[model samples]
Target: MDLLRVRAARPAATGAVLAAAALLAGPAAVAQGDSTTQSDSTSPGTTQAGSGWNDDAYRGEVEVIPGDDETADMVSGVVFEDADRSSTHDDGEKGVAGVQVSNGRDVVTTDSEGRYELPLEDGMDVFVTQPRGYQVPVDEDNVAQFAYTHMPQGSPELEYGGLEPTGPAPEALNFPLEKDMGAKHPHQSCVIGGDVQTYDEDEVEYARAGAFSDLAARKDYSSCGALFIGDVVGDDLALYDSVRELSGMLNGPARFLPGNHDLDFDAESREHSVDTFRAQLGPQYYSYDVGKLHVVALNSIEYPVGDGYNGALGERQLEWLRRDIAEVPEGRAIVLATHIPLLDFADQGSDVHQVDEVAEIYEILEGREVITVGGHTHSIENLRAGDSLTGWEETFGVEELPFTHLTAGAISGDWFSGEMLEEGYPTAIQRDGGVPGVITLEARGEHLTERFTARGDDGSTQMSLGLNTPAYRDWFAAHEDDAGEAPEFESPLEVPQEDLGEAWLTANFWMGGTGSTVEVSLDGGEPVEAERTQQMQGEGQRVGAEHSDPTAVQQQLVHGGSIADRSMHLWRLDLPEDLASGTHSAEVTATDVHGDEFTDTVEFEVID
Candidate 1:
């Protein structure tokens, strides 16, 4: 064993991001036009990044040197600096010391010589935790190649082919890293997406036109890149290749965790469930560092023998988590990401949609500055510290939040169900009334901020302002069960004289929570505080059409989508019953915990 050496901050000669081998960014390009027709011209694929012009997937791969002739008991590797930009380490290349390597449970740092050895198991993933300032090699499709899967017997018979059997353990699974200044810079933007969930070729094109194109147009996240926190596909694992192609369309390297839908239903056991996903995407769970932040991507779903799936991390993974967290330096900013949320406001009542061991996980990171992000719930919830929910306390025993728990809204909102827009995608209005979008986790100095950007829309599209009236609620009650067949809620914004007393202005602030505030101003008057529907403190959920967003529900009712029956981010303020019956314009503003304000306008009327 050799003593550790400090890694220099300097980068290699090549200026391109070696991990993504991102095609040279030039002037922007416009994606293919949409086929669907719409009165509004706002659509996805209207503008795109240069990466879409040439869908290059020339990024290299990981180098796995075969083991010796005799059966090996260990999987060994050297973490080296790829000075010449090759994915493989040449004889002249030197190993970088102090880089961490793992075999699911054991985490060992490289010595001065940059070599590490771990006891190997039959179905373990041998991986390297990408250190700060350096990036691991990526496959042709921009999928990071930090880990190598070792499956001796492969998976038991499954619908989609699992990992191909590796006859013997590799002698050396060397990982190559390239220096990148942008990756370690203090200011970083990391994109988190939920539920790409493309079920068919048409849905694939929808994703291409929707979020993927949106991601392609943005060049901000070259370092931390984008992490699709599961549901990369819908049921069919063969679509993994298509998803990989989608990743190649990104302007940066892409990482993904396994969602429940990305499962192998034919598997006999949980051990081999996501084998094909691991082979196609990265590991089932892993960690990496960028600047001062450490991100741990976890596989939160658990499918058992003779049972359906649940939101439980097996003991094996729990032990791995213990080891993984122990390795991170104390006080380092940690971002815990999962496919199914650990704890969320949307599914605060369900046992399966939330992690079963949330309290235990919280205990593990007690002293650190941490924020958790997750997918699968298909809603945007930004629950801040000290926020509490009745079901959260009863089900998970979490009295109040220790830190932030964010439910990153889905890219394929409401599973691509709604009126087809000219954007070539459905208006996937989420169950929370939030439009389909992705979360951008930004690091600013010591604080990390999370912002949601709607698909094909600007940052100004943060909140939806509308009127939720008694008449609209009655219509919702009538059409509640008529999904995909409901008649349009007639004149939703116009409230009759009788219902005006009970009508309220609603603002669906997508990322609003306990510390956030929503204010309403009628006809340029003073802004009045709008009450949040759910306080998230020991109260049973108040769900019904009354709590729903009129803007989203109106769109969902006639077209087809998840009805916005209840949302934690919703706020309502009663309209003045004595106001004259005429057209009136109101301004709604939502201020988040970070003190950033988003303003939107709604024009409504009172009728006789």
Candidate 2:
């Protein structure tokens, strides 16, 4: 680790960046015509700071490893410094030592000469896990290119098309890497977002104004960039360009995974299902490194199973996963990013909504510090280890989770449902009462803390509190179909004396999970602990008035959104039946797993 160097802040000029690289940056090259362009004047091949071309992966040439024979049953590769930024491993450019490469089921480290060989199988995807301070090449759309498909035969006849098989095994496959001028270590902000499912251009604009705009305004997370955990676009593959445009707003490198909605449903077979997605995004499953953290993005959506998709990883991918983790150095922090969750509080009742082989995945990650993130549920659920759910137990026989699993709330909250907001977007409250937002994982070495940022709200805003009155419950039943048409529920603070006994104060803590505590107090009195609605301890979803969040339900019922019928992050406290007739204020404080406290207040009246 002593040999590792920290990257610094970039200089304004491209010439300054080249000068700072110790002349490692080769001669200036012609600007490449890409669909998206940066605001900075730096050439695409330059490794200058603030040039917006800081990703080293974008500045290299492709080549084959020097001394390897064809017709070999083993895969050989050389990881080298792309001095010319040409992607090809030129003669003058030397091989980089101590790099980790994988063949989906086995891991090998480049020797002193920066060359490695591993047993190869047909149709296997060979890739190099990028190291810190170095970047792999990225395409015009900023999709990282680190893997090579070695399919001997092109994809079978399918609608979307699978990998065009390479006619024969190459003598050697080489990987190119450029030095990162702005890499950060020890402390990093990684963005984990979910479900930007834009069905049309209108929704694309909504995403632009909503989460994308919010992300664009933030300067943090430039190190690891942003990872969209699947559903980049709707079923229409044509909209991939629009999706790329959305990512263009990001300040750092952008990566994506595939979701059920992102599949080629018209494909004749499963192998060719994600062809268009692969052509647009990067690999279906891959890994990368930042500081001491190793990030693994897995494809969890299995299409053409029968009538619909299933949350599964085919045997090959699973085998690759086993090999990938085996290569990770012991004690390094691992972050797993995927489309469908392994086990989610939102879909604890459905078998098809979560990964089918959670136990196997858990076993692979055993004895390691890990955090898993997914986006299919369109809700925010920060579940920790030891958390158990009925669905997981019945389906995968998972007694308890082995690590933290966070279901990232969607950027297009509830598929862009609800009334339009003044911010040029919809409220789009999610099914679990969480607002549309991006999740931030602040990492300092192997330990990290997770935080949620609502689409337009400040960082401090974490939960919404309101009184669930009898009148509101009646209104919910009557306006089930009146989306964006029903009148707003007025007089939230004025509750009749008759309704005070049954009324409950509801708290919708967006990222709250097990070990979180919510307390309520009236008029600054003694705070009473509020019970969480869904314990997720092998029980069914709790719904109805006692469990539902009134604040989210109000907007969801009348404004067209996923019904807030059950929530894992919702908590309720029954109000006192014998209260003096007067106006009172209830102060609510929610403390998450990290001991971070968020306070909110709501006033209600008890009139005789």
Q: What lDDT is obtained when candidate 2 is compared to the true structure?
A: 0.75
The TM-score leader among the candidates is: 1
The runs of at least 3 residues in candidate 1 whose Cα sits more than 4 Å from the true structure, single-residue gaps closed, are 1-58
Model 2's C-alpha root-mean-square deviation from the true structure amounts to 10.8
Q: Clash totals for all models, in order?
A: 2, 14
TM-score of each: 0.90, 0.86
The model with the greatest lDDT is: 1
In candidate 1, which residue pairs get closer than 3 Å at backbone N, Cα or C atoms, i.e. clash?
A: 67-171, 388-536
lDDT of model number 1: 0.78
The 0-to-1 C-alpha lDDT of every candidate, in the order given, reads 0.78, 0.75
